[model samples]
Every structure is written in structure tokens, then in C-alpha cells.
Target chain A: MRAKTADKIATSIIIAVAALIVLVLAGLLGYILYRGLGHISFHFLTSAPETIRKGGGIGPQLFNSVFLLVLTMLITVPIGLGAGIYMSEYAPANRITNFIRLIVEVLSSVPSIIVGLFGLLVLVNLFGFGFSLFSGALALTVFNLPLMVRITEQGLKGVPREQKEASLALGLSKWKTITSVMLPISLPVVLTGTILAAGRVFGEAAALLFTAGMSSPRLDFTDWNPFSPFSPLNPFRPAETLAVHIWKINSEGLAPDAAEIAAGASAVLVITVLLFNFGARWLGRYMYRKFTAIK
Target chain B: MNSIIEINDLDLFYGDFHALKHVNMEIPEKAITAFIGPSGCGKSTLLRTFNRMNDMIAGTRIEGSVEIAGTDIYSDEVDVETLRKRVGMVFQQPNPFPKSIYDNIAYGPRLHGITDRKKLDEIVETSLRSAALWNEVKDHLKRSAFSISGGQQQRLCIARALAVEPDILLMDEATSALDPISTLKIEELAQELKDRYTIVMVTHNMHQAARVSQQTVFFLNGEVVEYSETERLFSNPTDQRTEDYISGRFG
Candidate 1:
């Protein structure tokens, strides 16, 4: 075959593959919205589910998902950033460092269901935390921490070597050079990765099933005190996130409109994750501009 | 003129590779010294040793002593940070922080705890003027360092190095990446800077060494083959290798 003809064939195949991916994504999104959008309303979004009734809502589950995400991030960000900085900047390349990297890679690839089982065994039973939001957040941390560390490490490594050299040659302390020069340049990548991880936390179900539990206590939204048992802010209370609620409703929900509730909840979950992905891109670009002064 | 930097039997190794062998020289204060040699011949490596920048490289070892202002810089008592503060370096590529023009100049000062706004402003102005960049960038002090042209960015880097008021300034092929006009501008700036700061430069261009430097050192295979006044070395080279190199016989 002629080289030009072969090149044309290769280009078409590549475009067809890319188009197939976009088509699949669009079809999935269209089907979910078509089945779920009609059922969505302010009442459906803000009211509690009816266990045996024809009408049900996912208000508390939605709030639980958001709250659990915030809690997990509060625990994960500091630990992840610290570990990442050490791995990228401070840690010498040795057997120990390589072992730590191997552990992180292994941890990230662990099945979410396995993580849930482990959470049930350790956090719920051994630690005596019970099936609470705190336990779920901890479980999610195990799932998300590896990702955050890898992202931060890669981001820091992406910074130009000359930037670090320039800062050091100016007599800046090692710590100052990292915090002032390196971190700022890598912030966009780190921020985007953090939000992408947050999206994972939002849509995660299996990990939360055995840790956060499949039921929420009657929540008092007006009770802003974190220590109160009934307050939504309480991390110790049993909570069901949107993804878990969708799973439970689809499996054995007693409600007559269980399928509709599941569909609607799934749609909401998808929308939230999509929003997070877009937000990460936009925020990353915005930060890069703010930090670097590039238009 | 009094010598400010003295090297006594200095040798450097990058793992198994001997980079600099038995180097000895006394560099005068407030003058320009240029190291001209072929690539990988240790001109840049010797420049890095002045501020211990080579310490960042893995498996890099050194012997003998390098003294600045009569103190052995390799001694345990000499803080690397303080040593670096006294000796500033500009690299081949212009590497201004991804920040405003003003911030790039003020970065060194801020690191050493200079936070007063007015004082930082004065340092910014004077440093820029010293680098001959003040008039061009005065109206755009808040602009990003990358917003300017490449030549301006190189000048901005020079300004950044000058902001800390170092006694010794090292330029490692500082204009190699620049256009001819920018290169000429930097050469002029180096000539002016040597009146106050001890200047050392490594250059691939031999004419650059002859044009700007007072003392010229020629290296071959990690050893200095010639060290003398630039005029004498170029016009009346004593060594056969130096004569061949200067007359464009070979690297």
C-alpha cells in the first residue's frame, strides 16, 4: 500500500476511536438525564425519603455526601501535601523511598470493596467508631491519600529545575525556596488533583457502605453545633451518601418509587462529579494565571 | 590589587569522573575573570564550586580548599547559605520566578528578611538600574517576568542577583541563549559591574572573554593550561595549547 493511503487510514482510525468515546459518554449522560430530570424538583431535593410511600427524596443523602467530602478533605489535604513534599523534595532516592512509593502505588490500586471491608473490620469494630461519618471519612482517606500524594509529587516535579536553582542561588533557605518558589508554581496542578480526588470521594459508594452505614439518623439542619448528635455537622452520626443511597434503593428499598429515586440520585451524583471535573480545569487555569501573570 | 579568592590544590570529582584536577589560582577583587574552555572541560563546574552549587549533584566529591575573603569556604564553620549570600550567580538561561518584575528583583531581599515596603522599592530600583533595565521596565514593574522579551528577562535575572548585594557575582554563560544585541548589552553590563563586585564568568565565546575579562583562564581536559591578563593570553600566549585554542585551531 502507498504510504499516503496508509497514513490516511491511520488518521481516520484514531479519529473514529476518539469519537466513539465521546459518543458513549454523551449517550450515558443523555439517558440518565432523560429518565431523572423530570422527577427533580425543590421538594424532591430538600425533603426526606418515604420508606414505603410512592414519593421519595434524596435531600439528606445529598447533604451527607457533601459533608463527608469536606470532612475527608480536611483530614487528607494536610497529610497528602506533607507526604508529597517530602517525597518530591526532601526524600533521598534510596531503598526506603522506593519502598514507600511502591506502597503508595499498591494502596491506590486496592479495590474499593476491599477498602470497605477493611474499614468495617478496623474502623467500625476494632476502633469502636461504629458505622459513623468519621469512619467513612477515614476509609475514604485510605482510598484518596495515595492519589493526592502522587499528584502533589508529580506537580512539584514538573516545576522547572532552573526556578529552584535561581531561588537557592539567591541565598533562600531550603524551606523558603520550596514554600515560596516551588509550591506556588505547582499549585495549579495540586489544586486540580485535589478537586479530582474530591470528586472520587463524592461518588464513592462501596467504601462508604460498611463505614458510614446505609442509614442516616433524623438530621436537624438548623443545629449548627458539630458536637450535637442530631446536627448534620456531627461526624460521629450515621450517614448515607448519595451514591450509597442509590445503591441501597436499587437493591432492596421498600419504597414503591425506588427505581425513580435511584435514577434521580444517580443523575445528581453524575452531575456533581461532572461539575467537579470542569471546576478543576477552570480553577487550575485561573490559578496558573494568577500565580504566573500569564494571560 | 588584592586577591579576594584563593584556590589551593582544588580537585573535583563527579563519582568516578575527575572534573577538575589540581586547580590553583588567586582571583583579584573588583575585576572580571573569565574561564574559557571546550564543553565538559570543567569551566562551569569550577564556577559552581565558588558557591558550592555542585553540592546538589549526587556523588560529587571535592578535595583541597577554596577560600573567599581569606576564610576556607569548605570548612564546617562556613554556612552554605551565608556563603551563597556573599556569592551570587546568573545562569545561561534567564530564570526569573513566575512573578511580577518587582517581585523577581525583591525575592532575594525578602528571603533575608527585608520586608519594609519602601526599602524593597529602593533595592528594586537600584538593582534594575545596575542591570541597565530600570528605564525599560519602570512602567511595568507589576507585570509578570515572562511578559517581557527574552533579553529583558535575562537583565531581570541579573537584577535579581544584584538585589542581595553580593560581593562576588558569577555568570555561567549568562548570554549564550541571547541574541547578539542582548549579548553585547550583558557584556557591557559585566564590564561596569566589575568596578564594585568581583566578577567571574564561563563563556564558550573566546572573543567575549577577551573583550570583557581582565584575567583569562584556559582549561583543557579539566586542567588550567593558561592563566594571565586577557591581553597577554590572547596576544602573546605562552602555552602551545593556549595559542592553538585562541587562534581558532581547535577547542
Candidate 2:
């Protein structure tokens, strides 16, 4: 009887804690939506900023955020994935590998503001890229690479040893086994990591501030040329992403409706990050099912 | 019968631990040879040496020679990939590759560069049939390998090993984790497979050795306690250790 009573009390306390977390998340989301939804309008979403007017959209900033994300992912995926495979499958587990791992862990734990400083020094100033999308993407890559490598390594290591043994026993070479068997098995987890990294890239303001700069050129939507300064395809142009724009509007925005714009931008940023987290889980499940045929 | 695998003064060590000590044995071709011993007696270790599967383990060292069909497998000229191709192995657990049934069987053939769809289909069929799982799984070839029962999964593993067209099939306690019915099915499958491929199995069940294998090797403390014709060894003992073990006197 005493044991059952203790169990009941423990269960209630756990439930109360879980409920508290849910309530906090719900309250925060509700509060943001309530304040921001009123300011979100068709004109506010599509038109460029007008310093003299009350209604100005974050059109260029949105495009810049999406473009920056694409460029960063393009650079980070191949290098991070290859490094992960080498670390997990080929490298001998000696002091050298351990030391490298320790370095990666330390790098991952470094504050984003420090990474922004690094980008400002090496990519923006030293390399003379001069506040452009390319510099920003490179900065984000350095910030996210350690995370990708760590996640991919864990995903690869999570695979059962029997799978590798079975593949090798069938006379497949080690590389072949890794490519055909191991990679496919670890695909879902790797993809989840990629999405999570993307979410981080989407919202990162500190790193982009120093590397991408706080201004955007007037883009010619019709210009498809990669070399044009105003073309969205040009990586050399200065891009002000959504998070950075929000930061700019909050601190030094000169427009009459700066507070409203900041609220709307914050809402959009939060929504995008939420979508990424949810999409990561959904896609991970879908891939696992497709590959393993589990219901 | 001619000998297919010859182990001469073979010794195996895992770091400071001596696993198999100066073992010598000859396994006949197209016959079922069984290795039986108590836990950690190195029966499985000897089995792994046939394909050099122990090479994956850190601090593992092999001394002397293990030759298959007169070719020394450990020689510098030998490619480990080609050697493994000729000698396939099945593990204690059912380890399907979390792929479609067709893909699981086709995985081995695909690795060796067999890309023709019809050829892969045909190989999948024959391998599944040889493992005696064709009738049960024929309709679900496109389904996931994990969708099947444990017994079916083990049989799928057997079919996978067979898909490589190996000269020898090594079973390391293949049915030790199965139900009685599954165990019976695998034991029967092993008997049938021996007619085509040289089958070597390590088992803890003495009765399984008696029922399935033509030759039986008993191991204890990293040494061969007794090895002879299965019938002779079981019915009339040459070694007292073999007699004691068969009669269920301490392993």
C-alpha cells in the first residue's frame, strides 16, 4: 500500500513537470502570435522598407536569409559528411583521433559571438571579401561544421556491428560496405542533423552581423546573372538576413513602425525554426520507414 | 572426400589472452563439419579464422596458416576481399541489412558487380530457395527484411550468405538463438546445403552436431579435446573428455 502511494505521488509530480513545460511553450508562442499577427500584412510581407512611410515589408531580408541558408548548406554538407565518414569508419581510435574529437567538442561549445569575430577577422577583413553573402556563408559553415561532424559520427556509430560484419562476410570491400550498407542505414539520422543545423543557420544573428554586414543592395528580381551586384544569385553582395534585420530594427530602426516590424520578423523567425524541428522529425520517420519497411 | 580447409599449427591471440592454441584440423569439402564446446572454449574463434573475420578485432594476432583449397589465405599476395568472397559467414544472430528481401539477397552479388536486374532476380530466387525460405517469402520479396519473423530472418541471413556463391559457408551458432522449430528447419537446411557447399558450423548443442555433421571437433580450454567421425565419436569414445561431455558430465 505504501509503495503504491509513493508511485502515485511520483507519477503526479512527473506529470506536473511535463505539463508545466507544455504550458510555458504554449504561453510563449501564444504571446508572440498575439502581438505579431496584427502587423503581418500582404504589403508588409512583399514591399521593400520605406524609411519615410509607416508600412514597410521585409522582402529583401527574407530573400537574403533563404539565400544565405542555401549557400551555407551547400558548403557544409559535403565537407562535414566526408569528415564524419573518415572519423567514424577509417580513423584508428588512438590518441590522435581522441585529440581531434576533443578539439571538435571544444569548437562546438564556443560562443557564436566568437565565431562572428573569427569571420570578421579571417573572412571579411583578412581575405578582403568585404561584407558579402560569401563571407557570411563561410562563417556559418565554420560554426556548424563541428555539429554536423559530431552528429554524423554518432549516427554512423549507432549502427549495429552485425550489419558491417554481415556485409564484409559477403565479400564486400570495406569502402563498399560503408557506402552501400552503413551510409544508407545512417541516412535518417544524418538528415535530421542537417535539418537541425539548418534551423540553427536560419536564426543565427551574431555570426552573420560581422561577416554579411547590416545592409542589402536593391536587388533586380529580373536579373538572373550571377555576376550582377544586385542579382540574388550574386554571393559577393552584402545581405541583411531576417534575424539580423530584426536585431537592426530593434536597436536602431528609424522608421515610425519599427516596433511592429520587429514583432512580425520575430514571429516569422520562430515559425521557420519550429517548422524545421517538426520537419526533421517527420522526414526522419519517413526515411526510416522507407528503408527498413517498419510500419 | 578431399579436404577443403587445412589449419596447420594455428594459434590465435586477442591481446594477452590466448584464444586458440596451436590448432590443426582438416575440413572435408562438401561436408558438414561441427565444432562443439562450452562457452569461451574458442570454437567460434576457430570458425572465424577460416575467413579471417578476427582481423576486425583490435590486438588480434594469428600464427601459422589457414589454407583453403591449397591457397594460403594469410599470404601477402592474397586479397582479403576475394578470399572473403569465396568463403561466406553467418553470425549467431539474425542480422538482415534492414533492406528489402530482394535487396538483402542481391546485396552480395551487387558488391561483386552483378548489376543486371534479371540476373539479380534469378540469384535472389535461387539463394532463397536453397535456404528453404522461398515458398514463405516469394510473394514479399519487395518487402523489408525486418518485417519477417525471427526464424525467417535467420533463414534470410542464410540466403544472403548463399547469394555470394561461396565455396564454403561458415555458421557460427546460427540457430542458437532460434526456437525449436526454427532450429530444426536450419539443421535440416544445413544438411541439404552440404551437398553443394562445404558447411562448417559451431554449436553448443551436442545433439545438433550428432544429427547434422559428418565430422565433429570437440574443443575445451582453447585446445581440441577430440575430433573424429561424428558417429564414431558419439557412439564409441576415443577421448575421455569427449565421452564425459557427450554424457553431460561437466562441460
The native-contact fractions of the candidates, in order shown, are 0.72, 0.80
lDDT of 1 by residue, A1-295 (tens): 6999999999999999999999999999999988988888888898999899988899999999989999999999999999999999999999999999999999999999999999999999999999999999999999899999999999899989999999999888889999989988999889977997899899899999999999999998899899999999999999999999999999999998898988888888888888878977888888777777767
* Candidate 2 segments whose C-alpha is farther than 4 A from its true place: A1-6
TM-score of each predicted structure versus truth: 0.98, 0.97
Instruction: State in Å the error of residue A280, model 2.
Output: 4.0
Tell me how candidate 2 scores on lDDT. 0.91
Instruction: List, residue by residue over A1-295, the lDDT tens digit for candidate 2.
Output: 9999999999999999999999999999988888888888877776787665788888888888889999999999988998899899989989999999999899888898899999999999999999999999999998799989988898899889999999999889889998888888998889888997898889999999999999999988889898998898899999999999999999989899999999998887788778768877898888777766666
Which interface RMSD does candidate 1 score?
A: 1.1
Worst 10 residues of 2 chain A by lDDT: A44-53
lDDT for each candidate structure: 0.94, 0.91
Q: Write the per-residue lDDT of candidate 1 for residues B147-208, one digit (tens) a residue.
A: 99888999999999999999999999999999999999999999999999999999999999
Candidate 2 DockQ, CA atoms:
0.77
Find the candidate with the highest TM-score and give its number.
Answer: 1
CAPRI-wise, candidate 1 is medium
